[model samples]
Target: MYSRSFNIKKDLAMRNEFAKKALDANPSHPQTNYDYGLALCNEKKFDEALIYINKAIDMDPANKDRFEGFLPLLFMAMRDTENSLKWLLKMSERDSHSRYLGWLSCVYAHIDDLDKASDYLKRFLDERPEIKTLSDYRKVAPAIAKNL
Candidate 1:
């Protein structure tokens, strides 16, 4: 986990260096665009982040995880329910067994859809029943912080 965080940090730094070079030469490169968007997402600059994320997606939507993860979460953080739900459905279809169900629990909670939240919460808990209360949830759950 430490290595993954280190790599994310390292990747961000390397990408920033590369971004400077790209900016000096031409900012139109797809990788530069994507990396800039990824960096912006890491920085929590969602609106600016989305511009480049969409640019990268338009250039090549084949890497669906980029759009689905980075873009949708940006919208979610911004409280843009429309786009968030749209991507949530798409992501759920792509990988229902994934940890994203934990996110779904939060979304449903946010919308005051406790019933659905409870359903997904049950699934999430059932997936790893060891997590029962908020205290235990802090540790027993996966490394990624997602609502259950």
Candidate 2:
């Protein structure tokens, strides 16, 4: 367990370094900013991560909806359910993907809104027949699943 945790930290540090170098080389690049933001998120630096992530979204407004999907989970990790719900609700309305339904369910569950959570969870499962169990859901979204 200790070794696994240490290796995870080391990997995140390496990721942050590489992403920082890439962002420095091309600060205007949307993908580079997004990648560095993701690295910061992996390190649990939520505020700094948002700055880069939002910058990336602003740089490429055409793909804003797609780019913003990660925000709900990031906010969930920060224990900011209000923001998480805000993004999840936004994505649920805009995104065609089924995962947002699952995320919505997870956030609802986290907030003790079981009726809404179950409704979203059912919708998610209906869309994704392959995800038949909590274990299967965890495989696809461990962070969100853990809340359930």
Candidate 3:
């Protein structure tokens, strides 16, 4: 009997391998490429990671989620705040709550940009009210909290 496995680490590895095989079989599946990049980012291979992530975006630049959210979010995790901000700035004009604002808040705070950090944190709180009352930010940025 074959049972389904629900391990994220295993799934992530499977996704990476499946992505590689899928790309080899059909060189234009953007979703597979994007999944690969996400896995690579999760594995902490940011530099080599960008190659696959860029391929996905280049294939479909209209997919703002790739460029504006996932890719830049990974960059922010890698502490590439400059590039992170660049991509985040490209998304600033959009309506609705801000996703990158949280990254900005943390980076700006790290860099002594108190005014901007404070501003971003407020915006982040507005966008996610539940986050305001929480005693832990680590529910999201666990690696960062480990260092702090």
Best candidate, TM-score: 2
How far residue 116's Cα lies from its native spot in candidate 3, in Å, is 0.8
lDDT of each: 0.66, 0.80, 0.65
RMSD of each: 4.5, 5.1, 4.3
Winner on lDDT between 2 and 3 is 2
What's the ranking of the predictions by TM-score, best on top? 2, 3, 1
Which is the leading candidate under lDDT? 2
Lowest lDDT block of 10, candidate 1? 139-148
Can you tell me which runs of candidate 2 are displaced by over 4 Å? 1-10, 142-148
- TM-score-wise, the better of 1 and 3 is 3
Please provide, for model 3 over 21-91, each residue's C-alpha lDDT reduced to its tens digit, 9 standing for 90 to 100. 66677668676666666666646787777887788788888884745456556666677778877766665
Residue-level lDDT tens digits of model 1 in 36-97: 66556545676887787677777777874755465556677667877876787777887786
lDDT against true structure, model 3 = 0.65
Model 2 quality (TM-score):
0.80
Give the per-residue lDDT of model 2 (tens digit) for 1-148. 1223434566766677778888888899888888788778767798898899999999999988767978888788778889989988888788668988888887788789999999998999899999988778778884533652
